[model samples]
Target: MNWVLLIIAGIFEVAFAACLGKAKETTGNEMISWYVGFLICLAISMYLLVKVTQELPIGTAYAVWTGIGAVGTVLVGIFVFKEPASFWRLFFLLTLITSIIGLKFVSN
Candidate 1:
């Protein structure tokens, strides 16, 4: 359950980051709304991440949270945001996931 929350925190972190990017790209009031949403989500994600860290090892929690966020952000950027889709990109993302799984055992 704690791991679940950590993963959620990671995902939200990715979302907020993407929103920040989009907000910067937009114009006027809509841009302000996006930045606001991004900031709020960022704060919540950090709070949840801190909660998970209290129970888990610092190294494990940080690695997993950041790893998930990186991979998830790339995925969302490619699929939902239509940034790009390529074999090389997918290959790297897979490598990241593999590394995270490896760290789970290695850190423990």
Candidate 2:
């Protein structure tokens, strides 16, 4: 289903973004692997996004994709990078998730 594709794309979007962050953190040329991984994931994510957009509303698809990416990136930044997960940041993340869900529901 298109909805399943949309969700999968969102997950891949988050994965590629997290890989990009990791690539930046790598000190040596080994980071190239992350770059490659990022690109591959990015391509797949975009493909799925375009497919979903063909059948769904742009606003809805984009919001869900971006929201999932944002939340997933913040979570990776906190857990993988040992970044602080402040209360305010989590609050806004929750807000973003809520808005994304609301948009999806309304659009459908």
What's the CA error at residue 82 for candidate 2, in Å? 1.1
Model 1: lDDT of residue 91: 96
lDDT (0-100) at residue 34 of candidate 2? 92
Error of 2 at 45 (Å): 0.5
**Candidate 2 at residue 54, lDDT?**
96
TM-score of predicted structure 2: 0.94
List clashing residue pairs in candidate 1.
none
Any idea how many clashes model 2 has? 0
Q: Report RMSD for candidate 1.
A: 1.5
What's the lDDT for residue 35 in model 2? 91
Off by over 4 Å in 1: 105-108
Over 24-107, each residue of candidate 2 has an lDDT whose tens digit, in order, gives: 989567799999999999999999999999999998898899888888889988999899999999999899989988887888
TM-score of each model, in listed order: 0.89, 0.94
